[model samples]
Target chain A: MQGLTAHFGGITWAFVLDLFTDYGLFLVSALGLYVLMSAGQVSLGHAGMVGIASYSAAVLAVKFHVPFWLSLPLTGCIGMVAGMVYCYLLGWRLSGFYLAIGTFAFGEMMINIWLTSDYLGGAIGFSGIPLLARWPVLLIVLPPIFYALWRIEHSRIGLAFRAIRDNETVAGSMGINVARTKLMAWMIGGFITGLGGCLHAHRVTVITPTEFGIYTSVTMLLAILMGGLRTFWGTVLGAAVIYFGPWLTTTSEPRDRLMFYAALIVILMILRPQGLLASRAAR
Target chain B: MAEYLFEQFLIGISTGAIYAIVAIGYNLVFGVMNVLNLSHGAVMMVGSFGVLLLFYLGIDNFWLAVAFGIALALVTGLLVERIAVRPLKGNWWNIKVATLGAAMFLENFVTRLTDGRPMPYPRPFKPVYYTIVGDFEVSNVQLFLIACSLGLMVAMMLFLRHTTPGKAIRVVAQNPDLAQCVGVNVQQTMVLGFALSAALAGCAGILNAVTFGSTYPFVGQFLGLKGLVILIVAGIGNVRGCLIVALVLGVLESFSVVAGGSQYRDLVAYSALVLTLLVRPHGLFGEEGRTGREI
Candidate 1:
């Protein structure tokens, strides 16, 4: 209680900002990620790709002297292209647990390669990525992204992706282009995560490989899981819970925190197996 | 360079055998249950912890430790199924999520209890080596690990094939609905499957502690991940496929370490899994019908 009181100001501000920043971004990204995962293509390593996009934007803005406006979307585009290339290379072959493996490999490979390279600042990682992201920026950027994704989620294309998630063979029988739908989801998911990464990089003003490892991916998954995978807003709620839940709980132990997350995910799955918001089953 | 490479490669194979034992645990649960037991690796960790704690209590006997580890694992398996798994039955994703929770709980509990320190595990076999066929020198412990792992796999197979309970398990693995209909006591079978997997994991944990010299509190994540990767590489529920892939990964990882470096060893394992999955989703020797065999 004393610790909480002592850190009250920072905590309150962080809570509000986290609610806006992390929660908003996670909501935007989860839709895209859910789309891909539902298409029976799991990319466990996408957090790295998200990291790459974020860091790339940061580097371009801070080092290569690119304008923030120019770097942000460009970084996102790079992420999209990488996602496409990744999907093309392994998308068809990916399904079920195997796709999860491929994603994890991609993430691990990217981390290893980046960790060794001096250009991405390697082990020391990237710092001073420029804090161009602000409340106004969030207001301008987040809603549109969320609204766009929400639109997509309700579209026929979205339904097709959901179909694949439910049962690929059946989806194929119904003439849904499983591979193409997956490719699109991957691309879009990458773009959104990249955008989130870019914003995160700018906000933190520093980035490391650890910023985009399995933990980040798991966090995103947890947000989606906790919020309710079925609805877009649920992921937002989940992100808020994770983003600020720690600050609220204020436990100094990282292991305890992780345990909390792990326990939460399990409990959520058991209680609300369809996910927090529950994606309405494709009729 | 040759000597160094050979030593590292040997190390890789031994580590791979440890992973194989854990993979076998995942495969059994998956083969029977059709659900990914994300906690499978944690169970192995529990086994390690159980042995370590018992050993700390002045039980210097290696055999005694191993037996205790196995017994602890069996109990842990049963408890995990009852608490974490059974409640989430009928929901596959829930199983993964629940197991993950249980895993996190056990890992943190162990870490907190052990003060996050690395504890030494007494070697089951001496690290003394002998040159078998001139150029290839292998440690006695390595031989022991390989033999023990193979022996365990074979024993598991024999149990699955010959024993009444084993046949019942096979039936459950092959077809749970039919197995239940035929009065095979599906619930008990599931429990047995969990127990067997945990017991094997316990053995592997002991073997790993022996070879690696010490067990860390956070050992479960790495071990679990390797086992999960092996299971994916072998396909979801193919026991034979998992064993072969485990060995193949072990050998390949050894070669990659020989050619590249140790920092990227995990890189090789995950990449191999990705590549294998791309080429063959059913794994190296997996069949389409091999969904759930152990649970």
Candidate 2:
């Protein structure tokens, strides 16, 4: 068995484990974004929620000495509340590019707050986080999350999201409560993203404010765009590509890597705007 | 205390002038094309680099370097329109995302070329300070920035109001299909709009480099968004409102720095943006029911 695994470019078991954990995190966040996009809303601020939860959970673990199991759910609840409050207060009023900018501002605000606060470890990043999120934990956690998301996607609410995405006025005319449905999308997306953050914090054993900035938000967006936004499996495929595609094309020069990512986005936007795994019904 | 306040206010006005100039270009592109040029900031960075490259090549004339940079930016703008905007023209979301990709490409390309180091801008014009009042001083650069920005704004106003092609741009902005039906050369006008917007961005880049005495690959990242914020505050397509709102934002940012220190400056600015969007979604000068429409 070892020889058989070695034949695949001599990749180590540990590297494979790391890849799985990374995919788990990316998949959760990508799905978080997919939920919003399905409702015809784009948030350039999903990273803020991730950052908030990461910091909250990391603080609880490192400072309060709370156990991982309790801290994780508490972190998720914090994210849920923050997301709901933000959406109810601000997100409901904006749409399109206005919403994009609004969310972008929110993301920046989170980063700035993180950077300025010493309690969150500021620019140096919070460290000494226990690595509780192993491959087994991820394997165990992902299935239920996936099942729940799958259920949500096929539910009546999912139909409402699609209706809102297609046309808000028409959706309103069709008796869909656009505001409440969007609010639900935000809350659900936030909780999932927060869960991803918790997994990331424990898996990586360190968390930084910069880790959850506009760049990460944009990457999450790219994953959804590349995967095809309409389906769950597409998001999984996108998360896979987003995580491994760059690793597969690892270059010695960091500049080349950035260029490669940028080129991929540009080419993808030009050639396959609907993404690699667009739904058949979309066309 | 009063002297400090005066100084900060002066600084705010100068910074706001820079924002205004950049916001004007951003607003122009949005008005004519109805597509947010997310790459506008990256284009401005390219312009700054263009000037730096010229200076390295022994070009000491500031005006010459500025002209070269503006021309380079114009070309870049035209290319972006061709590649990112024109192809995805009626698809609003696609256009926004494509421009974002273009921005990422330009920023990374420059970062790669420059090796991510801050380049010192060539100080062609010497700083001359004058005492305005009791312990209040103003530099020649500040005055020049304000004067140049206002001059450009006036020139743009005249161009749009008087010239035939300028009028054609306005017509196209009003209704592209109508303009095309009336034989206004919609394609050329779109290109021209991009060129004009980019030229303004280039000018702002030169001014910013001079004012800050440095340029970097990511300089435009935040400033571009700030310009957009200024536009939003001023109303999407209103040139006069853009100028006023940019100044207000600049002053507000400066005051926030004085009140809460520099770290809170961005927090204050963005918070103000959220507040503005909430309180006056149509903007200070935007028409009602026209808040979210294509400019």
Candidate 3:
């Protein structure tokens, strides 16, 4: 009995550590997507977050030899500023379908640039990135970030975000300053996502543009929406499922994994159209 | 030098027309439903693959294969509407993401079937380059692509203007409930709209395949993405704008390739989109007030 319990405990703890590193980074990135979606923007361009941050961090770490400690937070700041600029310059004027297309185009364009720019290693991807991030880095960074996102979700700005999401005309009439509120959401989301990107870059010794494409964006969105778009806890559940679900369901086939994910999304959307935990829109 | 430029322009316009047709497909669906069908791109690939399938089954006539291909695309588009879309009705965000899943499914399914390889597509015309002037050459295939796209656009416009079903589609676009009250059969109109849109995508796919002289499972990704870009840049529901913008983008891309190499051709289109978002938030030809901000 002792032997079985110890083995079980060992397996559980190991899985949890793996979860904190791999899934935790995804959660941080996903939280950025969550905030953006909360404002009803529905951007497909967000893969740029991972692309921009990971490459920047990788470049800074390898070329400039910036200490790992410095590069991580720097990437977040860069992402925040970049996000705000994109929102302010490009996003402020658009909404609905146009915004989706614009963002999608932007994301594709970045991928194109990544594929062509030989300076950034081109299609071969940037490799030999210092794998500085581990369990501790995520451990320290995650709790506070999770708390911050939760508070932001419930804050006055967060309330305005919900209002805008529920109905923009009403939210505007109620004086939500829809554009500025959206900007804030983008900035915060960008920052967190950038942090995730930096950690992710350091987690793997190589970085490829494929990691930051439409599928990644969709995958992040899936996690958030599936967990229930309204709460951080649901996001945690979503992160958990995405990490663990594949273990039970996925076969050795490579492309089949994407098919599995797409099928899962379709099935989930059909079963729980409002999301797993979504109930009445919070009053 | 001028001849070379002219040759490039001719090439650009033909490809642009192909894009215009694809955008028209998206415009039809978006106009009527206000939902962007993410699977539109995959369906374009479906059209090409559909024709390829017919060819495999011993269909020797190129035109006949095309007919079957368009039919296949129409079916797939309708299925997207029925399965990925309708069940998540009125939930705009859910519909968008679900359709995205549909796109992924189609792209990957084809990827698996073909092992992600580019397959050679059959062309209807023999290789024949026509010289309009000294060294200003145009291929018979280019002329056919240009003519068919223009012909299809004109036909679609006429259909929308003159036909009862097209009018019903217009009415639904204007207001589904009002159209339904007037006995327009809103659901049927929407299905028809999906069919027409998907058919157009089918046509565009074949045109693109013939342009490249081959097709691949992933070809739809770029083709479909370009369609959406042109759709917005041209302004929603503005058919004329779609033609003009798509042609201009195609021309610009052709020039950019000459100036900055083919690897950077996409920069032109995406930069244009970002610039449009910045300078003309309502799109180049879109109406001024509909920034989509309202609930």
Error of 3 at B273 (Å): 0.4
Task: Kindly list the per-residue Cα lDDT of model 3 for residues B1-295, writing each as its tens digit.
Answer: 7887887888899899999998999889887887878788899999999989989999888999999999999999989898998888757667777888898889988898888889999999697988876888888888888899889999999999899999999899989999989999988888899999999999999999998889998788788888888878877878889989999999999999888888778878898888887788777898887774421
Q: What are the candidates' interface root-mean-square deviations?
A: 3.8, 2.2, 2.6
Tens digits of per-residue lDDT for model 3, A249-274 = 55556688777777777888887877
In model 1, what is the error at residue B6, expressed in angstroms? 3.9
Q: In order, what is each prediction's RMSD in angstroms? A: 3.2, 3.1, 3.7
CAPRI class assigned to model 2: medium
**Candidate 2 on B95-164: residue-level lDDT in tens?**
7678878888888888988898999887757889999766888888788888887788889989999999
Question: Across residues B1-295, which tens digit of lDDT does each residue of candidate 1 receive?
Answer: 6766677667766777777788888877876777777777777877888887777898888888788888987888888788788887656655766787788777777787887889977777557879866577888877887778788888887888899998987899888999988899988887888888889888887777777788886677777777878777776666777777777787788777667766567677766766776677666776775422222
How would the candidate models be sorted by lDDT, starting from the highest?
3, 2, 1
Name the better of 1 and 2 by TM-score: 2
Best by TM-score: 2
Error of 3 at A28 (Å): 1.5
User: Which one wins by lDDT: 1 or 3?
Assistant: 3
Q: What do the candidate models score in CA lDDT, each in turn?
A: 0.74, 0.82, 0.83
Tens digits of per-residue lDDT, candidate 1, A107-211, equal 877777777677888778888776777767778878777787789879988788778877777999999988888888888877877777777777778788766
lDDT of 1: 0.74
